[model samples]
Every structure is written in structure tokens, then in C-alpha cells.
Target: MKGLGPQIPTKAPPKQSPHFRLYARKYAKSNAWTLKVKNPEHSHDSIENIMVHPAFRKFNEQETSQTAQMSESLLMPRKIWAQLCSQRESDRPVILQYIYNQIKKVKKDKVQGRRPIDALIDTFKEENFVWSSERDA
Candidate 1:
């Protein structure tokens, strides 16, 4: 009567979109959060892709504290990285550069805008370490 088969428009429809949108909300009464996914399909598989992401390589709180303690103890970043890798058997190994950066960050925080020598002197004073310097005639 009208048409024998489906109709194809003169203009092509829009291409398949790859965007994935996820929304999260927390209710005032509940301690849990709810996640709403607009597009459940993911662009890539997480299992194979997660290890390559930089965010996945970040240290957790415990690792950060351990790194700080090790750095304060004068352990080299490479050794610290090795120790961290040995402690964790994750798919992504702890990077040496990350260890170096973390140690640098810890040291910077410890210095707190003051010079390193000043911080060291403060630490020595706190620990009651005595040092006397003789004036040259």
C-alpha cells in the first residue's frame, strides 16, 4: 500500500558516537553513592588498558607513608622503588621515576619553604645533636 520495504532518508544519519558519560551521586541520608551510566559500553577493555594508565601507578596512603619514611632514612629512590615493587605484586610495577618524584615531594614538604640546611638544623636541634664550630683566628 505505502512502501514495499524500509525507507532510507536522502541524508545519512549521524555516525556512532564513542562518548561514554558516567554520573555519580550521594544521598544525604545514605553513606553509599549511586552511579548512573549513560553509555555502558566502554571504548577499551579495562583489564588490558588499566596498567598503561598513569593514574593506576600512583601510590596509596600506606605506600606514600612508607616512601616518606624510607626517603627520610636516606634510602636511594631506586632501592625504594625496588622495595615497593617487592611489597606489591600488582600488574603495574612501581616506576623508579615515580619513586624519585615521591621522595622529592616528601623532602619538599618536609622543608616547607625553608632551606634544606635550615630544616636539617631544626631536626638536629630537636634531636639534641650538639655541634660546635671554632672561629679561625
Candidate 2:
């Protein structure tokens, strides 16, 4: 699902906007999901703006691998975005939001089912690190 571009506030009671709707229906027999369009007459000005939309924007395989590796190394999202942008000059520039979302997903995958603190503790143990905590009175 892509954004409908920037929105402009209107003082009028009724704001003019496209009424496009899509529905996903599950087949009763097969339990398969199928998409159905309610209205096809959607008004969109330009297709180029889709490149900036986070939902529609995508990273290539190389960029995806790089993002995963960098995320594992604990690199900041902004730095990762800059590195990706500098690596290539494509028609579609990398969106910072996309990078941030990707990094979040990567980190979540790394943590898997374990709690974040548990994962950190496991990492520390793997590295032979030590820490101690004291109760406050």
C-alpha cells in the first residue's frame, strides 16, 4: 500500500480525495487470499513520487545484505542510509525512513524470540565479558 501523496488541509466540510478501496478475500475452499479492487478509478498525478513512498520503495539484494551486515555491526541508521546513498546514484534515492525500518527489522530478526536483555547478556557471555548489579536500598 502506497501513500496518496501529501495532503492539504481544507476548511470546507467535504474534502476532495480519491475513494479507492482494495479488499482481500479468502477463498472458503482453498483458504487462499485474493485481492479485489472496489474502485479502479483512482486519480494519481504522477508515478515518479512512488519512489519516495516507503511502502512502495524497495532495496535490491545487495543493499538488503549490506543493511543486515551493517545493522549487525551496530551502525546508526543515518550513517547506513548515507553509505547506501553514496554507493549508488540510481534514479530512486534511498529513503531514510526505509533504512530505519530495515534496520529495525534486522535487529528484530537478530533478537529472534529471546528478550532484548537476554540477547545482550548472551552476547556478553559469548565474548567472555562480566558485569554485576547491586540492589538499591
Best by TM-score: 2
* Residue 122 Cα positional deviation in candidate 1, in Å, after optimal superposition: 2.2
Q: For each candidate, how many residue pairs have backbone atoms clashing (under 3 Å)? A: 0, 0
Q: Which candidate is the best by lDDT?
A: 1
**What is the per-residue lDDT of model 2 for residues 27-86, given as tens digits with 9 covering 90 to 100?**
999999999887677755556566676554589889999998898888988889889988
TM-score of 1: 0.56
Model 1, residue 131: what's the lDDT?
A: 74
Which stretches of candidate 2 lie above 4 Å from their native place?
1-12, 15-40, 46-50, 53-56, 132-137
Candidate 1 whole-model C-alpha lDDT, 0 to 1: 0.83
Q: What is the lDDT, from 0 to 100, of the residue 132 in candidate 1? A: 55
